[model samples]
Target: MAAGRAEETTLARLPGYLTHVALSFVKPDLIYQGGLDLSATGLQYPYSGTVLKEAIALLKARQPQLRVLLSVGGATYHGWDRLDEAALARLVRDLGADGVDIDFEPTDPRCVPVDGRMRCADDALSIDIARRLRAALPRPHVISAAGWSVGAYGEGAFADAPPRSPWRGAMLALLRSPAAEGLDLVSIMSYDAGPSYRPDQAFRAYRAIWKGPLALGFAVLPPANGGPRATIESTAATLSAVLADPKAGAMLYALRDVPPGPPGPDNPDYRSLATLICVTLDKPGCDVPMP
Candidate 1:
């Protein structure tokens, strides 16, 4: 049996609860290239920039235990090979943010079924950097990874009704690696796989090894991203079902970016979903919406 299903998650080792809802996507490439004031770009990254610091300060003020993480990638992100982990940690510290969410979406090393197992070319990079991140920012500072929907389809052990996704096993290395212990959370990018992938099932597959705070992510993305459109009803059903697990969490892909799709706007979404997550698990701080 996969450990995520069989093993009783050690609550003590994992976070007490996933407190922060994770305001995302502070583009590492831009920060790496020096983009302290993204607000200057005028409509590039509104949630980020100098305002991001204020956001963090406000979140912390609301709940001293809250952790505001700076998400670092998106669907079109690149240049994982060159990410300076040290600089990233420093940036997190500088921003007054609690930690970093390594949202890596590399194009290469797409894992393939190989020799009764799955393998990717540079799979080690995921955990290697995770370990580095954990080392750089120890306890109380959270480190999480955003996983691909069908990223854990190895033939044996890790297998769990694999979906027909563009990249299979792309994230298995990180989850299965020993370094995964260094991570505090792993949010599954459970959308964007079209009809073949079910968000709930993807969450189940990941539960096999990721015994920590495993979040089932929701997205309000554009049609250009190429996925079945998300309705509040669907998002509600998925979160309601998956969040039944005590360790399961709710994560929105973006609450700030003007997602180019209908119903992407945050009105009923922020209200309903945030309320649902709060009421369901009794997680505090849902009163203030995600930024």
Candidate 2:
């Protein structure tokens, strides 16, 4: 429901409903300058390189349960020291993406509370960059991680906020250790991190440190450096209390964003929070339209 941006192509006019389309930044200096410019990726698709793989082959020839992922350190995450790993697994196997979304927001190990709990600083190089990008792209090819909406504040009852962030626990020091078994899902950018964020307690503090599938991040603009985000009736009351647990879902930092600020409900875009996440994931169309 979230994993927004990828220019939201909205998949070119809300293609029914998205499954996973995260084509944001691949910055780490373009995976240490091994390749890609794609003739400057789209702002709103005027077309680029081989017509951008012919619009990703007309979007998997029309949403064959779309899965395109190629994001890396997007919206944040400075540098996790280094992760070349065969040039980011050869740019996710030369842009035929379906994996890699490690949005690790590292700036320099901060989160220090020590004795009272919470302590961080690279946590073993962020769990060895999620176990070296899942051993350089293995299993089904997906690795998500955009978490850090107050990295589930200092444990023990999420130890009450305010810890002077540098992405505080930085995705709770890589999904509370064991490198989160190299992830399969995690998206919690829960809007600007001010106005006291509480997207269902940042999804119950990252579902108390990763338990597989989890999304819950939404923001169709508003919060460059101004607090208070998430509207549309608090994103439908936090996606109906976090998707009523059917392996919850929702992540929208962009879907052709620009929905303005100050209680973001002027609604001129982001198709009313992607039709309120297609009527809270009842799925099927949810009145698609909006080109």
Candidate 3:
């Protein structure tokens, strides 16, 4: 189960709580560090030092075998331009993390290029950072990024526009870069495309451009209206359809919205969604199976 938020104070306490939750309720083999937004550095989202330390300590204590990664950048952060190789190396060394997740959205308006033409600086910064992190870290660290929807990007829409679509060509360029050589995964924000969006659309998008490991991210809340369950069924169906294609798995945008149901070793909705993939792909640790 990938956590969405982790601060310095909460990081230390997370390992134990996660372990207890996993052991007692749902045992996820992998957990993504919620995130430490770089753009939030000095803003309202000032970086949390305690969260980072506690997160590291928790991984060391409760789930050493569990893969723990740090997600850098987010919807609001766009300071990737300032991250050089040296700084990235230091970050990896200090954090003792296994990998980094880049979720920077270019359309945030805050990322507007001073000279226009959507500068490649952000992409370059990410590649350099990935290279440095891989070199400094002894273990194979992961480099992941989240992209926009295919239709939106393919159609040539503005970056911040609704559906702020993913540019397939742009993404492919990043994947092919020297720095991306160490990239282990890529998660696509498949939600909010439109009410008519289908799972096949996502599959076709990835099949057309990506040849690496992929994970689909679905939102539990509606794109415009904050509601529930709009994603669970579709997410499960999408997982069932794509599990056989070397796709890693699916991730719910959040755990908080997961519906409340039977109180056992599993939440039926989560279990069912996870089961569809495990059964189809035969992934042992994809998720904790239903009883």
> TM-scores of the models, in the given order?
0.78, 0.34, 0.60
Q: How do the residues 122-153 of candidate 3 rate in per-residue lDDT, one tens digit apiece?
A: 45654565665566543565556666554222
1 against 2, candidate with superior TM-score? 1
lDDT of each: 0.64, 0.68, 0.47
Candidate closest to the true structure, highest TM-score? 1
**Which sections of candidate 2 miss by over 4 Å?**
1-15, 22-58, 63-67, 70-84, 87-95, 103-118, 121-124, 127-144, 148-152, 155-168, 172-186, 189-199, 203-236, 240-276, 281-284, 287-291
lDDT at residue 269 of model 1 (Cα atoms): 46
Candidate 2: RMSD to truth: 15.1
| Model 3: residue 284 alpha-carbon error in angstroms | 5.7
Ranking by lDDT: 2, 1, 3
- Clashing residue pairs, backbone N/CA/C < 3 A, model 1: 4-207, 4-208
Count clashes in each candidate, considering only residues at least 3 apart in sequence or on different chains: 2, 7, 7
lDDT of 1: 0.64
* Stretches of candidate 3 exceeding 4 Å from the true structure: 1-52, 108-139, 151-168, 225-229, 256-291
Residue lDDT tens for model 1, 112-225:
777767788768877777887788889889888888877766545546464554477878778888889889888888876766667887787788767888888776563345
TM-score of 1: 0.78
Specify the poorest-scoring 10-residue window by lDDT in model 3: 20-29
